[model samples]
Target chain A: MKLTTLAKTVAAAAIAMPLMTAAASAYELVIPTLDYRTGAYAPNGIPFANGFTDYLTLLNNRDGGINGVMIKHVACETAYNTKQGVECYENTKNTEPSGALVYQPLSTGITYQLIPKSAVDKIPVFSMGYGRTSAANGTVFPWIFNFPATYWDQATVFVQYIGDKEGGMDKLKGKKIALVYHNSAYGKEPIRTLQKMSAKYGFSLLLLPVDHPGQEQKATWLQIRRERPDWTLMWGWGVMNQVAIKEAASIRYPMDHFIGVWWSGSENDVEPAGMAANGYLSGAFHAPGDKFPLHDEIKKYVYDKNQGTGERERIGEVLYNRGLVAAVWTVEAIRKAMEIHGTKEVRGEQVRDGFEALDVSEARLKELGLPGFTYAVKITCANHQGPGKVALQQWNAKAKQWKIVTKFYEPLSDITGPLIAEDSAQYAKENGITPRSCN
Target chain B: MSPDFLFFLEIIVSGLMAGVMYSLVALGFVLIFKASGIFNFAQGVLCLFAALALYDFIAPGGWVDRWFGFTLPVWLGIIMTAGVMVIVAWLIERLVLRYLVNQAPIILFMATIGLAYVLEGMGDILFGSDVKPLDIGLPQGASDYMLDTFGLYVEKLEIVAAFVAAALVAVLAVFFQKTRIGRALRAVADDHQAALSVGISLRTIWVIVWSVAGIVAMVAGIMWGSKSGVQFSLSLIALKALPVLILGGFTSVPGAIIGGLIIGVGEKLAEIYVGPLFGGAIENWFAYMLALAFLLVRPQGLFGEKIIERV
Candidate 1:
């Protein structure tokens, strides 16, 4: 055991040698990834970490590192633990010329921890789609970003999808919609938005929270069975997702009406349930499958060169693709930062500006070879979440794939707008930060 | 008949079924604690390690396929897994536990906790962190007859787990009652010095007892892993059976069983009936609270040996 510890110490030092030296350099843009590759969340987390790291490698190999300057990416494993995630942040936050370009704390709890720290350090924390939804109001949360769609945006869009199917929004009146959420800050993020929407649509909403590491949810599911809700939308992660799907199947619930947030929809979540989890729909920003043009690029340049990160096959899984999307945005923000600052090497603060001004148009999507894969994303000075949009996808059991089956649902900023303003304003007031207008 | 009453009945029935597996896990802790005065904290993680090994044996994943070249059949795979567990038990005794013998019981207990961390890390390295489905052709899904007949709505797997737990208990009972080694174990449990003098080697008994616990842990791993997935959380849930240990009593086998059922049933009912008033998810701590309350009243547990230290 001592030998093993010594070996691990030597191995860690060997891995850290580059970053330690790289911190003194001034040429490359260093993005330190506080990722969870080893712990309870690793099964779901490994692919995301792999995809994130692989994208950086792919850029270095295929494009000679995000234009001329190489992208130096370092990962410190947090094991999906908040303390370790924060520790990773503090340890790796210092990288060369200015500071670590940006930190993406994938776990929401870790993201929450880093929010104030990043603002203080002037380092942007990109939470992608699963952090505090109120962070969308860029006026208040200038350093924090949860772009594309927040959990609130997801709830409303899910309602829209259900409305689209049932003729219209008015048709949802008096309908019972259950939200089986994982009981956490991440899980509870959607309730307020959902409650507001439920009132507007006249739909009855049931909130059933499954505690952390949700393995024993027999009682929760049994409640679902008795209530017989018209639709059940799950906000779950890890083992909770798989268990919920299986329990839903066992209760003979119609798989079509039972939808889950993107996190709840993955190969890991559904494959175990086999045919029972068929037709289980979920909201997604990016399509699943490795058939994308960039995947071919990733395959040829990355895996073919034997520079891949994880199982060669899991390159385009739901979360893996989400990781790819996250990396693309992070790099895109840096590029915008470079363009705005008119310099090859930009610091952490400049990257925040780049993120605000960054836009992924339909033409740009075509240029990036991700056309029709996702919608044109645009971030403004005031709205950090961009055009918060997500489409629906369903699990095809026979083929074992997540196939996007709907066009992007427009985000209902009308409901989410006021909530964000109120929440962000409250946050700003509590923190004693004079809000930026950005006009 | 009101639907509420029927649903209540359903909850209780399902809770008992879930409790059966908890009893299986608690049973392992009981066996080890009864024979040796050490609280084996790694009993939970043993479930995880055993399950992972069983999965690797049954389904030779990428790493196994690279070297071994073939997957063992289910029955054969189980035997191989049991063999691996026996080696693990032997190693634990020879390496760690052997050194701690005659030390304070609390010291021995703390050593097992340390062992759990070491074994957890080892488990992660050996069997990667990915969640593997432990489908050894174990029955899953709801029982059609139960669902159709009385709206009982019980999982087929839970029923299988209950029967498996019952069979394990019966076998364990016969082993301790009739077998010479079992007699040796009981003799050691009564008084280590007296048993040592009667031609029973203490080292051999410790190894045997730990091996039995390991086998019990292996069975639990299969039962629970097949229900959920063979992942880190399996070990974590296995730890949850701790509350069952206190309720059942440290030295009582039958106590573990009854305590497991009471806690399981109690918690499920609490979550279903009382959870809503408190905003739900009461099941998580409900069992521990019940155990804590029960322990206050009956310190010896449901069937625990009375602790009467002679002055």
Candidate 2:
């Protein structure tokens, strides 16, 4: 028995020795990705994970690793669960050598849990487009960033779009709007903004919440039918989005009148409903489809070399492109960190500075091979959310493509500004945080 | 009828239809538990696997197209999937059930939980982890005729699902009551050793029962998948069935159906009438609450056989 045990230990050492050596040999910029590749949400999670990982791989292959320093992407699967996400964060936050530079949780629930920890750990949490909206207040949430737009910004954009559809903002009076949302922190993020808008515009706001996994929404749609709201808005994710679109179609609700948040606007959400998903609108920050020059580069450097993270055909889906955009911002931020610190090796605090000082202009975007893909994002110490501009995209179900129908429009900062202040102030009081002064 | 009464009626109608869908998933559980005396936690994953297989066979540019170079007809794809499920059932009996003959029920249940993860992982590896639209010519969209006549909204897909569930129940009832193998299955469920002494093959009976459960899972998967695309969330519909099982009894087929109806209508009414008071989203917990209350009063359930143990 001792001989057999000794042999087994020897074999295990033989297997792990090479891997340990490879890990120890390189001094790379470590970015921990808390991804969900399996579970009920895997249908949506898989593509985004692929997009994020593939773009990082593109940097490794094409540019020879972010100005000569290799990027060591340590991915931990969370399966879209809050507990698992926190575990992933704890496990990868202090990886060997330089520790984790930044974290993109890709989940709102996980972001909420990590917000307090991030301040202590000083590891910046960049939840692109989906996290605590008040984290936009950079003073209170110095280590947290949700750039391009937050849920509050998207809600205001949706209200403005509805008003525009009705000819003018004054016409919104007496109009009824229903919000079908997932029953979670992520879905509830937009309710306050919509309520303030409804009260200001004289419209009735109806809130309907769907539980997790969200396969059954018959009751919610029945309510929508009875109310006959002038417009319906949804803040849903994963299967909830698909089920809501299908239910809306079943109730014969005009698809054109229904809108979803950016998280809800994806090919996986609409294709399930078939032709009925046509004309369904959703708030978007970036262009969909794989027509950009980055696609060709990724194909040449990643797929041709057989190192692609996902299938070749799934290049430019909405979520995939969103992941690409996320990777783009992350890489640019890393470059900014290197420039600021005057070294290739940087830590979490340095990356936090990089995120705060990010300035991805249109000319910079064109240089990065994603021209006109999205609006410019300029982050500052006082403003981590950037200009909260969102565009509306319509699903052409027959063609299986999303077309950007409106130009990028700004959010209602006049309303979101005060709400952010109030919410952040309350949060600061509860958490005993002293809001930092930028000026 | 008044507009308020009409709205109430509409909710009831919708609830009843939705209940039928839940009953379909619950039926798979009832079958496995009744025959094997083991609560198969993998039943939900089985439905997901079956649906993924059926989609792979029937979908354009799927496994069938990639490998065989031809798109399979819907009927043929279903039959092929049924064959695959039968093989899976046979393998499960041979590998897992055969070794654990006369094991404790909890042990068997734990084995099934392990089996669920294995099958989920295998399904992901076989069929890519992406949402695939499943269209087996099932009628979708709201029923215009019902809306036009009664001012009520009902989905055509739900109506078809109701018919399919009813038909499946009728067929299962006959299969269990009339067939010789059904008699053997009952004997095995009663006493494994006694059935073994009588020359009945326990392995064969177990395989047959699992195959039937697998086929039921396929039907439930198709119905639910047709409504809301074939995806991983399709497995979660089994969660909606737990209340139905608790209310109806795990071993009673008719109880599964009736319990589904009650839970469905009960949750819908609660969500519509009482949800507003709680800030909405009461549908998720309403059924479980009702089931808990029912369990306190009748632990054996509405149709479950009463247990009497001698001290």
Candidate 3:
């Protein structure tokens, strides 16, 4: 019995040895991803997690990590619950040598919760396209970074596309536009901006709030059928997207008139409705498909070596591409941090500074093997809303692909800028935060 | 008739049809409660599990072909799922229900909640968390002919679901009236002591009732799963079904069906016609508010029996 116990103790020690040594190493950047691989959102969550993880794997294997120091990626499953997300942040924020780098809370609700906490902890947050739109005002929210584009930016893009389709921006008058939004912080984020645009453009804005985990929208569709809104925009997620598309198709609503946010444009959302969802349009930040040069490297080093994160074929779906873009930005920030700090290794605080000073131009993107994927973003000391540009993707049933039909549109800064300043100021006042001056 | 009036009538028609879907789920709750006096909170998860099981057996890149060596047709897949549910019912009766016999109703209800978590976890584990297309060749889309002839917009899937729910309720009613085991179940539900006095085994009745509930759940899962994919949100239909159960009264089978329709129509009507006055999406709370208002007048529910205690 004593010999058997001794053997078990030795085996346990051996199992824990690599983890202990990895934590103590200064030659690695720790990125603990807060992932939701289970629960209601997992259908959408799995592909995103796979894309995010696989990109880092590609860099680690092909390029010998970021500047020779490897990445230590840890994933904790939050199941899309806000409480669990906070717990995951608490559990994995501290790396032994480098401390924590940055956090990307995939859920907007989770991002809101982590905002105050992240500030207190002095860790930068990256809410990539789907968090507090007012966090675009980096002067008020220095710690919160909603770079690439915010929901308000995307909402403005949708209105722009509508305006373009209607002949011109001046023709938006007397148009009946409706907003069918999820009833949460994530869904409600774009309401104020849309309301402002409605007043400016002389369009009627009908706001419909679908409760969380929205499945039953029969009555909502009936009202739409009766009211006959000329155009509708949906801020939906998971099963909500599929149901809305099908219900809209059932009522014979023109698919071209109904648009969903970027989060609502995944394959899982459209394929279930089959051919009926043919012309449905959605907001997109990054181009979808695996024809980029980075794909070749990823295929050779990660997937070929059997180190891929998810199903091999699903690497180029909408959400997966978004996840890959998020990681690309994350790595670029890390590289910028290394340069700014003039060190081979950097800490989270230095990384935050690097993020503020970072710039990913078209030339940098081409060098990184992602050409024409998305617009270049440059973060400034006072401006964190990097390249607030968005494009529209249309689902083609016959081709079975998401084809981008519009070039990226810049948000109407004349409207969205003041709204961001106002909301972020309110948040700062309520939370006792002193707004900082970049000068 | 005016187009406005026709539109109102069309919304009402769809509301009633959607209510039938809710009633189909409430039908499962009524069966177990009538026979065994347990709420069976796991009814929603059971619905998802059944659909997941059926879809996995037939869907390409699903649980069956990935884990097992064989594939089956859609009909055989459904039969295989039925067999799985029977085994699930057997395991529940033997392990959980059998031990908790004669416990307080609240305790039994809590145990079912525990069962819900277990089933949800097992479903996620056995079938991966990704949503699978659950097309068993069911007809989808609305009939253009119906709309053209009568200016009515009726969904073909909803109409099919309505007929299936009616057939289920009718068959269950006949079985309860004509079968000896059904009579034994009624006796047990009436009084456990009296059931024991008459040589009816309470354990056997409980097992039979649970198995019937499982089958009802499977049918409900198929319809809802067919509407959406076989995803985690399929389990949330339980919340929608609860208002139906409360309105229908827990013990009456036909009452459950009618109650489901009433709540469904009430909520839909409120959302479309009345929702404009109040911003919209009132379907979420309208049913609960309606049930709450109805309960104030009829505490025993629309068809539940009056309770009298002698001091």
Candidate 4:
């Protein structure tokens, strides 16, 4: 029995040693994407997932796999459920050939639970747009990276946009602003930021939350009508977007004054309302409409090759472009990680470093066929977010397209940073987690 | 408080429209329950499926495009949707619901739940995961002719909805009170065994009732699909009819409409005046609470006849 136990251990070590050696030489990186391909959010989720998958395929086909090391990605559908997302995380953490370098769980609820697990597993989570706003502080969340912007960042940009439109910040004083948000962690992430800004700007912030599977909002909008808010910031998802627009239009609320979060702006949302969505503006991380050079290349190389991820026509829609940009960010992070590690076989720790070390400048973005798109992103020990700058786009009736009007603006970091630290500290203390030492 | 008062009136009007939609859905539920003595939980999914079918028919490069070599117009597509609903109703009667005719209501209800999952899966596979706007050519602009003194701005669609709902209810009422099939349906609803013994074919009654319910579901689907666009989330809206059914009694037609209006208006007022005192979004739980409270008081609902079973 002892001999057999020893032999089994030896065999296991022998099997593992060669694979480890092969991993070092081969330079293979594996990324697990938690996708919601079939659920209430599936309409938006599927296109994004497809764009993400297509970009990796494009890299493999065009660049010969990120400096000759093939990039592998496996998508496990979460349907936007937290339990299923966590299960997918546990199932794909350690697999053959490589360990998971990073995980991007799109759902904020799942991200909250995975933040602690990421520390124990040494795998960083890339919550590009959706997750805990408090995790923007790298000091508290060492293993989590919420790059580009957090929900708070988006909220600040939105409030600033409203202020600018209404003449100045002073004009916002005494003006009522309604926040009609989804009743979930993802939806509520912006409330604290809005509250802070409301206090500073002297705007009366009215809170309205719509329940999940948000189809019925007659009551919520009725409240909006009562408040007679000058502007409304909608943080809705899926069917809620269309419902909100319709209800607002029904009550004769000016659709132009109603702004939505990034998630709320999509072809699906506007197409339902048709001309009713003419003046509605939304906060955007990536430019929408299928006119970008990268999208043109995708159409030529990918869709023309009959290897397209979805309907060829939907290539440049809001959600599709967002997906493609998300993929580009993921790949860029991998490339940075590989560059620092001096090898292609980058592990989870290396990927985390890659995320932290990401320096995608305007030149780099232009080189990648994404010009006038985004700014330089730098993640540090203290700041997980690189920079929060979002452009405002409006739906044009004559052109039948989304036109960007406002240039990028930075979020209220001075207020948001302290709030993030305070919340993160509270979270750590409650969960018995020790704050990571950056020094 | 002028704006607040105006908002209050607006909520009541919109809430009444919402009630119309819920009643249309509840009409289907009551039809099935009266005929088969079984609650069809799958009714909600059926509404979603029908709406999705209508969207696909009108959408560019859809089945109509493949089959007919071109996209059909919206009105024609709607006609095709009606045809599709009929076929689906026939199929349901032939395949699953027919077999469970003599089963206990609990078993039949469970079967409907299973059917709901099946329909939801089929919808996802058939339509692809994308929300499509339901375009029914309904007037979308708000009515400028408002009673300025009362702070009321009624939408043209709301007025159309009220007229259409009233017309449908009146038509159905007259049909049931005057038509031969309507009489047979009522007879069957009262005692299926006795109706069968008296030479009323149970199969015919089941098929007819299901077909009528299918048509009712399509009307509900069209109104809602036009409002929110035809997305999978419409199924959840269909589920709101359950509370309507509880308040109105599963066998009452007028009760369904009146109960839907009361629930809708009540929830809206509650959320506005009372919801903030605790927290916002009280509308989510208010419907269920109202239904539970009503059940405790009336037991058999506003219109349901009391059934005293002998031990």
Worst 10 residues of 1 chain B by lDDT: B58-67
lDDT per residue for candidate 1 within B1-311, as digits (tens), equals 58999898889988898788799899989999989888998898898899999998887573455578987889988898899889999999999988987999899989999998888899988888887877899888899998998887899998998888888888998889899999999999999999989888988999999999999999999988887778887777755688888888988877888888988888889998899999999897888888889789887787888879889
Q: Taking the tens digit of each residue's C-alpha lDDT, what string does model 1 give over A343-370? A: 8889999999999998988888778767
Residue A18, model 1, lDDT: 95
Tens digits of per-residue lDDT, candidate 2, A1-439, equal: 6999999999999999999999678778898898888888997888888889999999998887889888889999999999999999999989977799999999999999999999999999999998999999999999999998999999999889888989999999999999999999999999999999999999999999999989998889889988999999999998999999999998899999999999899999999999999999999999998999998889999999999988899999998999899999998998999899998888899999999989999999999999988988999998989999999999998899999999788999998999999999999999999999999
Candidate 1, residue A198: lDDT: 91
TM-score of each: 0.95, 0.96, 0.94, 0.92
Candidate 2 chain B TM?
0.98
> Top model by DockQ, which number?
2
Each candidate's interface RMSD, rounded to one decimal? 1.0, 0.7, 1.2, 1.8
Per-residue CA lDDT of candidate 2, range B1-311, in tens? 89889889989999999999999999999988888898998989899999999999999978999998888999999999999899989999998989998789999999999999999999888997789899999999899999889888888998998898889989988888899998888888777889999999988998999999999999999998898899888878889999999999988899999999998899899999999999989987999999999899988789987867779
List candidate 3 segments past 4 Å from native.
Answer: A1-27, B64-71, B309-311
Docking class of 1: medium
- Please rank every candidate by DockQ, starting with the best: 2, 3, 4, 1
**Candidate 2, position B226, lDDT:** 92
The C-alpha lDDT values of all candidates are 0.88, 0.92, 0.88, 0.82
Candidate 4 wrong stretches, greater than 4 Å: A1-28, B1-7, B66-69, B73-75, B147-150
Fnat values, one per model, are: 0.52, 0.81, 0.62, 0.79
Q: Predicted candidate 3: interface RMSD?
A: 1.2
